[model samples]
Target: MEEFVPSAAIAHFVMKVKDVESSYAFYQGLGLRGIDKFPEMAIIELRGGTHLLLAAKDDPMAGALHASRVGQRPDFISEKIDLMIAGHTRADLEKYRAELMANGYSPADIAEAPLYGHDYFSMLDPDGHGVSVYTSHCGDKPV
Candidate 1:
């Protein structure tokens, strides 16, 4: 038997949104660049090489796409998905949180978690997906 290995890295993540335009605007507000627009989908480029595809849930193509996946399609709008982004330092995380707040994003109060060994904050997108920005470790604390 041979070990299975993936041929390539993940190029993008597809999020089935109730409204593509609203989701696109929400991500754009978070600083993601809109690369392309389609009738029922919008492509957004994040900081890294990965991209985010916001597709309208009711699009005809959505059914075909969901069928190809292993499990039932997730309800992205109301799902509890934690999209975490790493920050270089505590100050960096703090700055990001502040920026979101300044830009009309109401992120929850920052919290320190001993179990995770990090300080993090979370905010909800327009579709209600949870996005978290966190430092790997609490200041001077071991993971």
Candidate 2:
């Protein structure tokens, strides 16, 4: 059997948003830097390292750029894309978790997942991207 692996894996992700301005503004509030902006789309780069593309619904080429709307696509929003980021400690997880909640993003219960022995919290972005912060314990707890 032959298998192929991409050198860098995912290059970036493009998300279709109803309003680029609103989506750009939301990510900006989260400390992301806007790298590109057009009438139909806006690109925001996060501090931790990831690119976010906000594509306006009216964009003539929007359909070609995005997949089927998952969450609150055209109207209401839901968390469809679950993005997990790494945290080393509970404090690290709490820090981002609280910041997100205070900023209007509701974080689900912070709990330990037995499968991986990690503590995690989750939230959603403007376009319904599921973002999560987690601390992996690998079964060992802080003493």
Candidate 3:
């Protein structure tokens, strides 16, 4: 099979954000292409033209089952990470970590993942949604 940069298979996905401006800046820093920006919302385009819609939400996690407005805290069974970027190399992950650090963001150290035997790192956007960037273990395989 021919190896190609995969385009997003869907039209868009949304991240309820606390601040559009900051969220916009944050994703932009991570190399997602900027599309449109608004006071209440912003859109960042991924490699295949899929849009990551960043819309303002007073409490982005308010609707989360792990959290609640009026009830006992619940033990969450799911991860906070909503997006993953795959096509990076181990060295690319290191470079990205350094770049984020220099820009005043705290990103997790590159760690080895046994799943695909690749390295990855996680970071939080301004609104606190988790994003993971990792080396592609797909090699010549179509993913």
Give Cα-based local distance difference scores for all models. Answer: 0.70, 0.65, 0.69
| CA displacement after TM-score superposition, residue 111 of candidate 1 (Å) | 1.4
- Give the poorly placed runs of model 3, Cα more than 4 Å off: 1-8, 58-88, 138-143
Better of 1 and 3 by lDDT: 1
| TM-score for each candidate, following the candidate numbering | 0.74, 0.63, 0.69
Give stretches of model 1 more than 4 Å off.
1-8, 72-77, 80-86, 136-143
Please give the lDDT score for candidate 1: 0.70
Worst 10 residues of 3 by lDDT: 73-82
**Cα lDDT tens digits for candidate 3, 1-143:** 56686664777666667788888888888878999987677899875567887767754433452233255334532224334455557776687679889988898888765346667878777666778776666566554
| lDDT top scorer | 1
Summarize candidate 2's per-residue lDDT along 42-130 as a digit string, tens digits.
98875345677787766887776655445535563443443443456667777877787688767787875622655676666666776
Instruction: Please give the TM-score that candidate 3 achieves against the real structure.
Output: 0.69
> Could you tell me the TM-score of candidate 1?
0.74
